[model samples]
Target: MSKRDLTDKGTISRKYAKKEILKTIIGYLVFYASWMIVTFWLLYFFEEIPHFDWILWILFYAVVIPFIVVLVSVTWYSYRYVKMFSFEVLESDIIIQHGVFNR
Candidate 1:
């Protein structure tokens, strides 16, 4: 399928550069990794505290798993986004279209 916008001078439609996908993935990875480090560090710190042993398992199940799931979901979404993304330069305006949920 093609995403298009009409223009008097005709449309210049293009997909995002492949490098953009790599760049975005790297950025997200760095951000998530830092947060994850802090999260796990806190879990470790708390686990060392007296009577806080259960905090590790509880937080692991409640926080760590969800964070990992979100990370994977976002990565998949970004990859799909790069594949489907397109922009059309019209005579008077530009229209960009891409959606992971609805396209």
Candidate 2:
């Protein structure tokens, strides 16, 4: 596609693209750090309790699985958001488009 066509279709602004990339990186880093800390804390806590295997298993399914699901969802959503949403600064006005179907 031509540059004009791409811009008109809201392919994205360079500034916004960089910002979004940075945001995604920072979010993942924070998520991983928090997950590690929480995992260690839970392991230590469960170790203190007698016969906590069941509780550990329960927590694995309830907390860990959901946490993983949420992380995956957020990553996928962010990727979609970045791909689908874009801004174009025209001389007359700013143009924004979101969603592959609509565009």
Candidate 3:
């Protein structure tokens, strides 16, 4: 469609390109997967320390709780972010709207 048509207030808003969405998803998967791997490694490493059972307890809470909370929030936020995101081209300007809770 023409930029002019997109410029109309509510006439046309386009979502992100497929390549962009795929890239974003892959990036997230890589990041979170690495995080889990490192956390598990740390837990295993700490198990050998003397009297570090306390430390293990602390790590459990520090890693698991925050991981769950952050993961869920990020998932929800990204879903909303992608759903709400759009761009429009005007005659002399471009408008992009993104984000969910923070936008």
Better of 1 and 3 by lDDT: 1
Evaluate all candidate structures by whole-model CA lDDT and list the values in order. Answer: 0.59, 0.62, 0.58
Candidate 3, 1-103: lDDT as tens digits: 4654565443222243344445656666677568767866886788844356875775577655665666666566556556666565677765665433233
lDDT of 2 by residue, 1-103 (tens): 3345443444644465456656766776677668757876887888854357876776577566866676666667656666777666555665565544343
Question: If scored against the real structure, what TM-score would every candidate get?
Answer: 0.43, 0.46, 0.44
Predictions ranked by TM-score, top down? 2, 3, 1
TM-score for candidate 2: 0.46
Model 1 residue-pair collision total: 0
What's the CA RMSD of model 2 in angstroms? 7.1
Q: Report the Cα lDDT for residue 93, model 1.
A: 74
Question: Which candidate leads the pack in lDDT?
Answer: 2
Candidate 3 residues lying further than 4 Å off, grouped into runs, are 1-52, 97-103
lDDT of 3 at 36: 60
For candidate 2, the per-residue lDDT at 72 reads 68
Predicted structure with the largest TM-score when compared to the true one: 2
Query: lDDT score, residue 13, model 1?
Result: 28
Please state the error at residue 17 of candidate 3 in Å: 12
